[model samples]
Target: MQVLLASPRGFCAGVNMAIDSLELALKAFGAPIYVYHEIVHNRHVVEHFQERGVVFLEELEEAPTGSTLLFSAHGVSPEVRQKAKERDLRAIDATCPLVTKVHLEAIKYAKEGRTIVLIGHEGHDEVIGTMGEAPEAILLVESPEDVDALEIAHPEHMAYLTQTTLSVDDTSRIIARLRERFPLIAGPTKSDICYATQNRQEAVAKLSADADLTLVLGSQNSSNSQRLAELSKEHGVAAYLIDGPQDLKPEWFEGVETVLVTAGASAPETVVEAVLDYLKEHYDAKIEPRLVREENVSFPLPRELRQLASS
Candidate 1:
């Protein structure tokens, strides 16, 4: 079997910044760091931090007063920040700058009294947070069909925003539908989808077209990871979203000549390497590096955390 490895896969700048911030918090502060949610949506990444005494909480009230709390990369609502202040907890924001940009755009459009159409999966952490910015003003739409179903309060005054991690092609279709219905809809100055998500999806889409199968290394709850797997299937290849090699089944590889292995933005590269090792041992797979694009993006740590490190 031949293994086609997708370059620009696994940890992106946002994930790297989030993980690094958490690690520095551990060293600067002590164990038992209270994080609002999993720093990033990878099982392996969360488990590794849990072993180091990080506590993941779903609500601000769950954390003890005065404890240090960090927001996950999937930025939190302003209400969450206010609650943290009320609880007297030291808060460190680990939100990706790209996600933050969407939040800001939501605030901007809401203040303009425009009916904001937010394109994202319902109940997703990032979507939830972005909606919280203007619950009264924002309407969540997931599909092009949903866009058709929208009943804008004022057709002439409307804007749209999207979750940073979304299928570029799907989002474009949804946006087209929105424009078809509301020809006057406004949008952000640039696309809301981050560069890393676009690059990884493009790599997998290109590789999966030629490979017999595609294995996406990520957890089930990971939205971007799920999209990568879905994107592969859309490209006419069978794809599986697996956390690690342990999830791999021999039966799936039957009659497969080549496999495309890629990882999501939040997935650790070590998991990818482990999957490669398994493929080599079981199928004697020969690996080939397939590069669709080059990614060289980096984000700075949250200012509070940086000061903590310096202090």
Candidate 2:
């Protein structure tokens, strides 16, 4: 068996920043640190932090009052921030700037009385946060059918934004449907889908063409990882989204000759290498990295962390 690895697969700038924020917070403030959610969507990353005394909470209420609290990379709604403030918890925001940009757009468009259409998965943390920016003004649309059923007060005065981690092809189709239904719909001058998501998906699409099976290393709750698996399936290839090599099944590769391996933006490359090492030992596989794109993006740690480090 041969393993084809996808290039540009694993930790994006946002994930990198989010993870660093937590580590720096731990270093500066000491342990028992509370993170509002998984800093990034990778299980190994979250577990690593858990082992280091970082507490992951699903709600603000879970955080002890007056404790240092950090928001995850997925961003949080205004309500969550308000609750944090009410509780007097020290807060550090680690939201990806790109996600914050979409939230700002939702706010601006809503203030202008434009009905905002959000293109994203309905329950995704990012979507929930973005929608909360202008819930009254925003409607979530997951597909063309949802767009068709959408009823807005004024179609002419409307705009759209998307979650940062959507599939490029799926988003384009939904955007096209929105444009067709409302010829004057306004949207981002550029795509809302982040560059990391686009590059990773493109890499998977390119690699899945000739591979016998595709394995995506990521958590089940990760939207981007799920999308990579879906992209592979779209190409008529067998694909599985696994958190790590432990989730791998020997039967999955029973008749497979070539396997394509990729990881979500939040996934660690070491996990992928571990999976590859397992495959090499078990299946006598040869590995080749399939480069589709090169990424040079890097995001700095939060201002507070930077100051503390410099101090």
Candidate 3:
């Protein structure tokens, strides 16, 4: 069996910044640090932090008064920030810069009296945060069907934004549908999907074409990882999104000869290696590293952490 390992698979700049901010906070602020949400979407990452005395809270009120709070990489709405401020929780924002950019775009469009159409899945952390920027002015559309059913008061004065983790090809199609319906719909000059998401999807598209099976190392709740598996299935290949080697089933590899291995942005490379090791022990798989593109992106730590470091 042959294993095709993706090069730009795990720990993109945003996830790195979020995870690092948490670690730095733990070191500087002592244990029982409160994070507004999972530092990243991967279970392994969250579990690791939990073991290190980091507490993940879904609500701002859950954190004790004066506790240090770190926002997740998914970003938060201005309302969330306001609430955090009101609660007097010492806060560190770990939002991905790209996600922040989308929020800014939404604010800009709304300020111009344009209704905002967001292209993303409903209830996703990123989508929720972006929508909160202009709740009354923003409309959510997950597909072309949603666009067709949309009732806009001012189609002429509308702009579109997208979640950073969306499938590039799917988003393009949805954007086309929006444009067809509203000829004057405005949007960012470039797509809102993040570079890391785009690169991984492109690599998986290539991998799915050449491999009999595709294995994506990531948590089930991870939006980007689920997209990778979906893309492989779209290419007519059997794909599984697993958290780690423990989730791997031998039945999946029974007739599979060539397997493509990749991880989501939040997944750790060590987990990928564990999966590979399992494959090697069982099938004696030959590893072949596939480099679709070289990623050199990096994001700075949160402002609070920087200030803490300097102080």
The candidate maximizing lDDT is 1
Tell me the lDDT of candidate 3: 0.92
List, residue by residue over 18-82, the lDDT tens digit for candidate 2.
Answer: 98889889998888999987888888999999999999998889889999999999999999999
User: Candidates ranked by TM-score, best first?
Assistant: 1, 3, 2
In candidate 1, what are the lDDT values of residues 149-171, reduced to their tens digit? 88776899999999989999999
Clashing residue pairs, candidate 2?
Answer: none
Clashing pairs in 1: none
User: 1 or 2: which has the higher TM-score?
Assistant: 1
- Using all chains and alpha carbons, the TM-scores for the candidates as numbered come to 0.99, 0.98, 0.98
The residue-level lDDT of candidate 1 at 115 comes to: 94
Please provide the root mean square deviation of candidate 3 (C-alpha atoms, Å). 1.0
Q: List pairs with backbone clashes in candidate 3.
A: none
Q: Which residue runs does candidate 3 get wrong by more than 4 Å?
A: 307-311
Off by over 4 Å in 2: none
Q: What are the per-residue Cα lDDT tens digits for candidate 3 across 1-311? A: 99999888999999988988888899998999998878889999989989989999998999998889988999999999999899999899999999999999999998999999999999999999999999999999999999999998878999999999988889999999999999999999887899999999999998778899999999999999999999999999999999999999888988898999999998999999999999999899999999999999999888778877677
Q: List residue ranges in candidate 1 displaced over 4 A.
A: none
After superposition on all CA atoms, what RMSD does each candidate show versus the true structure?
Answer: 0.8, 1.0, 1.0
